[model samples]
Target: MSTVPETGTLALPPLDGLGQLLPRLSRRWPDRTALVTDERTLSFADLDRESSRVARALQDRSIHPGDRVALFSQNRWEWIVSYHAVLKAGAVVNPLNVMLTGEEVAYILADAGTKVLLASGERLDAVGDELRAVPSLEQVVSFDDCGHQVEQFSDLLAVDDDPGFTPFPVDPGSLACIAYTSGTTGRPKGAMQSQRSLVLNCAYAATMHGRTSDDVVITALPAPHVYGNVVINATFMVGGKVVLRKRFDAEDTLQCIVEHRATLLEGVPAMYAMLLASPALEDADLSSLTRSTVGGQTIAETVIDAWESRSGVPLIELWGMTELSGLGTTHAIHAPNVRGSIGVALPGVQVKVADTQDVTVECAPGEPGELLVRGPIVTMGYFNNTEATAETITPDGWLRTGDIATHDGQGHFFVVDRLKDMIITGGYNVYPAEIERVLIGHESVALVAVGREPDPVKGEVAHAYVVLAPGQQPDADALIAHCRQHMAAYKVPRAVHFVDTLPTTSSGKLIRRHLRSSATANA
Candidate 1:
């Protein structure tokens, strides 16, 4: 096992405001590369100066501290600059995913009570009119000129940097960012993260990953999401260079790795699956890569093994959520024996297992239960939704993570499944991840999702949707028989549907709701 850092017990500093850290880092690593988009690279010094200019421009427009600013764009250098610029002015940032519909975008803007919006010219048509309709939004700033309704981002950069602007007095508990969940449920609720929570999470990640100035981190995920934001900001916090990708493409990612000689790679499981299947990967030189990690969804061991076989680097599985600021548990790169586990609790974090009744359970090795987390890294609460906030955070400060997991005696945690994803069949509880993991081990299976199929007698039964590997043929009976060899009969999938591909979210999480709906529609 890799030696954990010797940070004796949780005597952390009263979280200093991010407003202070950004300026300090800017002064320390001014010449280092801070962000790299497809078309341009911004050094730390350039990012610092440009973001200061943006702060001044916003202030000149009467935007003040405690106001909410929205950023709706893909991962780009401008996005990074705008994020910090919003924070520099002590304003709250609301980053909306570009993949959202106009209505979804409108809901978030209104919910956050956003006063200003910063977006790219390419995405103007998608939400420009919708944002105009929001009464709470006082101003709209665009990366390019958009007639009268938008302020040009370049014009903002041309303004004189405000070196004399007084820093806002921000409390550690004040809202810093409102990141909306993917809305797998009904409407997405904004997860409120404070500057104290976000900065502490970044520091924890830096310690776990052993990040340094020499590491070049490639962020291929969208910045609007929590996973992408944490990785990008954490890289900067450690004085590492970040190579950004607007959209994830297997060939482009391989080329970026080779061209930039990237040392660290952060992506979700779908990105890895695509890269493993890409023809470009066969010829690409991936020798520069050393550290690679994945989160956002549960990853099958088969994918991990395939990636390690190809790249000579283990795919460290991480477990986190938007409320936790994107890191609660991560597999230690230095500890290869715990490759399938989500390593130990990150430095300054505590994790435990609780039964269905919310009682703390002393789980023996290999037993699974709901995972509960408490630490400086956890978010304070949801924005404005007091009911939801109270339900999520305990009175004692522990955040009930709705993930089902098991831990080995050695302290390594493996995600069994999601609490909501558990299917009840004949009164027997079944976790889809267990079935999915077993199915992926089959040679004929390329990708798979295990979900519940409605049954009149049982309410719901286990079902599998699988994509077959090219030229490999396997019938439903054979697949079921194969599963029987590794699992109990009740836990085996009752029905199987072969598909071309499983539906996944933009971030590469399998859209299980789609699967359920598809099964119902087909029936």
Candidate 2:
């Protein structure tokens, strides 16, 4: 018997690196539509040629092997080209979240030692002088025409494509990406993933999801996210078309499924919630969707059942993190649907629940513990942060996923809670410490602690408990406005509670779990 149920006839292609993905697909399916957007559509051949031209431009700029090239833009065709172009140039990719503040972007760029920055003109202008502070940045390329000191993305694409161009040969074990994930320490850390890891993830995800040439997927997930990256690349790996959107609008998404005749619809739970809430959902034609996927956070079984029942499609729940490169566990399309569970591990990956108190001990079935993963899918470690790497990964190579999960005897894993205080708001990881750091910056804030608040749409939202300084009156609006300015919109607290004292241990350590009770008592 197969470790995973055989779902589809789509076989994994021989891929050593992501750089080879487009070139190989273009050769076999040159005329097949590979990417579709409202702005334009690209055949496999067109995508390959455009990426080659951009790769030559990057090489001309002296972007050598292992050099960091950052793409800081929303989902766009150019963003896709830049990704493959960076790989073809034998450079490491650093995809930045478009929602990041100028300060946050600067920190990541500087930390990754990004040499070339490819972004939208608006984002560059927003960062303005901050880009200059990063000494490692040698060139700034914008997708749109911008002010001085930046190269135009169109100009690079206009360059003559090297007929003999091919992806630079690099070891499969070599680092291919530095994905920055926000940590509990109030800063983002880069997860270094190898070329083999990424390529395998795409292959496995595509195979398990039953993606093939006949499939067309619609998604609005950010390209910078590992989940989004896999969804995009997995489609390309099997010669499928992707109807990529810059942002998620429930009505628009439902319409796209009908318009594109999409076979797969993929998104987080919040997206499904919004889709269910949309008035268009009742009249929208969803006959084409054979399967859909939800991940990035745990979703209620009710939401999954409601979606599957209404659309006549299966909602395949999967679980993963940035450290896993893409997916650690997901359901095979042909397998039994196990609602409220994240299915089983991908074929070659190993997953086990270790006792929270003693990681060396494996938890019994139905016993919740910290989910530990050991496999090639795991990231090498946090880039330039050995201390964090050691803390997260054991000497034997088991990656502590920081998720409290229980393994059913039958191979399914059910997530219970987060081992860390980090909140998942609309599928985005919101570190409480990061929020606390920003909220503490406010002049009126004396002591602040952030915690997860249950949200029907977002799964969980950040709720802050504040203990104001002496002589300061409660100003929830002002404090929230302050966070809005310093952090991304998603990371902003939905509500703030003014408390006389925050719940803490006798040693003065703030307890995040008790925050909801404190809010209730104060109210």
Candidate 3:
């Protein structure tokens, strides 16, 4: 049995499911502002009533416990309502990235066996009839009045109040959400997050950060992202107000902070960089910000210092993955903020750096190795992929995070690199295998390999090294445009290098680590 670490002084009320959050908060602070969007603001009471009505609508459509319901849309009040409503209706919520192309969405919906889809009108339009091909998808609900064959989300909120309606009972250990994350297998894997895992993560993360009802947080991270989910749900758990934006924009983020007098700002490292570059940031009133958080990818200390010097607030660095439901490690609000470290594991969680060759052997304090975690925050397993799950999680319950890190003598963890070839750009994960898979689809590309290139604004961008077919002329723009159709814009390579050959080992495996140096020499 794994030993559970002490949680210290944080106290949280027990809840069976995420559906209970709104009802409990409404009773505590019904009239308090629960959510604020560019379109409108909603109180806790309003949010509860609206979500309940949607849950009723979902039930009306025959959604039930364990049924998969996908929410494919940008950040909006309806998306938030739909998330809670799915849980209330006793269905599993699968929030999808808005940046995903229609084909990608179709694959996820089909893979998750989604029974219903709640999406924005624009998203519905973008996907067109692609989602209809998903045999498991029984219904489509549009957030706006789009001419798609779908139900109107507005109609769901128009129903009569069912005061006696109660959310369905669910075991805390049952799956609550299926978050898809790109993996090295050239496909996205669904990380099965249990109700216990997600709820406890929110409680622990919120407590560690000293989140309270008095806080007003401003975030522009997409609603589908695991980090974004934590930011939204954690705030809701404490009855704090969340200022949701459709997307991240430097100027708009600054404006929201000044306008709302936001007590906390949450975003990835790239977002902070953008804010620092924003002309409005110099004159922006950020006095209301008591502290801020930066995560998703490693950030430069200079950028952290710049933000703190200008805003006069602590920039807490955190590390997490979809497999963990949200945060795995972070600094407590009262703890010492180690400049480069990702901080210690959340209370009740155990983290260690293991030898790459032998995971059973722990690495020395200053030695770098694979980071492994064991806790309730870890995902039960990858959805419907037992092979992948077995490869990731040890028999002893340690989940291999695929991240290279080292532990200081004081318990702080510092990430050194990624053992996996996955690249993170602008807080979004981009797998090299996925990009290579897309590139290989091009007829002009005889052989292809993808590698990460250092970028200034975005942490890293994909760079493709290709060996063209006979009689094929290399046109970088053409290949890039082809990628745009098959993949999301962010996944497209920043540059394409045409080379005669790529470095490969005797075993015929393309050596990605040596791609940059080889490509430079060959180019």
Q: Judged by TM-score, which candidate is best?
A: 1
TM-score for each predicted model, relative to the true structure: 0.91, 0.81, 0.80
Question: lDDT scores for all predictions?
Answer: 0.81, 0.86, 0.85
**lDDT string, candidate 1, 77-168, tens digits:** 88888888888888988988888888898889898899988998877877666776788988888886665467789988999766775446
What's the C-alpha lDDT at position 32 in model 3?
A: 85
Report clash pairs, candidate 2. none
Candidate 1: where are CA atoms >4 Å away? Answer: 1-15, 146-148, 163-169, 335-337, 360-364, 470-477, 516-523
The CA lDDT at 357 in model 3 is: 85
For model 2, give the 10-residue run with minimal summed lDDT.
Answer: 2-11
Model 2, 216-297: lDDT tens digits are: 9998888888899999999988778899998888889998999999999998765776587577899999999999999876
lDDT of 2 at 43: 97
Tens digit of per-residue lDDT, candidate 3, span 155-253: 888888999988888999999999998534567899999999889888877888989888899988777888888999898888788999888788999
